[model samples]
Target: MNEETIKNIEDEKFRRLTGVKRSPFEKMLDILREAARLKKAKGGGKNTLILEDRLLRALEYIREYPYLFPYKSKRWGQ
Candidate 1:
């Protein structure tokens, strides 16, 4: 989901959808953003997905299929 979609969601609904409260989600996003910045500084290749999208995808994967490796999943290619 995009930032606007996330912004319109109520706190409880967001928690239900992503399995984490808004505060923690933002905190996680901050960590991911820092990592992305560092990777960029190291000359890492650009990612197609933005940081928020990447974090959302990871959260969805964990919540929907906890046992599967993200890279091994068919949806990962998307």
Candidate 2:
């Protein structure tokens, strides 16, 4: 399908979801959890190491700049 059609489909799918959006911290937590799962599931590898590094950087970024996640608090009018 064309780009517009694809975008509309994705928008529709997103609108149909029933829950509030995840905060940046929550998202980072999920990433860390996934990284931990991957670490436990297999032996060490270059790809796994790279992914873990990326996840760590993401967590650090959110920690260092919490304002980046305004959606984290409903009181902020998010």
Best by lDDT: 1
TM-score of candidate 1 versus the correct structure, residues matched by position = 0.79
Measured with C-alpha atoms, the lDDT of residue 76 in candidate 1 is 72
- Candidate 2 overall lDDT versus native: 0.50
My TM-score estimates for the predictions, one after another, are 0.79, 0.30
The best candidate by TM-score is: 1
lDDT of 1 at 29: 92
Could you give candidate 1's per-residue lDDT for residues 1-65 as a string of tens digits? 78998899999998888889999999999988888888888896778887888888888878898
RMSD of 2: 13.1
Residue range 1-78, candidate 2, lDDT tens digits: 222332344444523331222244346557777877888688664453444345445555666777867766766876
lDDT agreement of model 1 with the native: 0.85
Give the lDDT of residue 53 in candidate 1.
Answer: 80
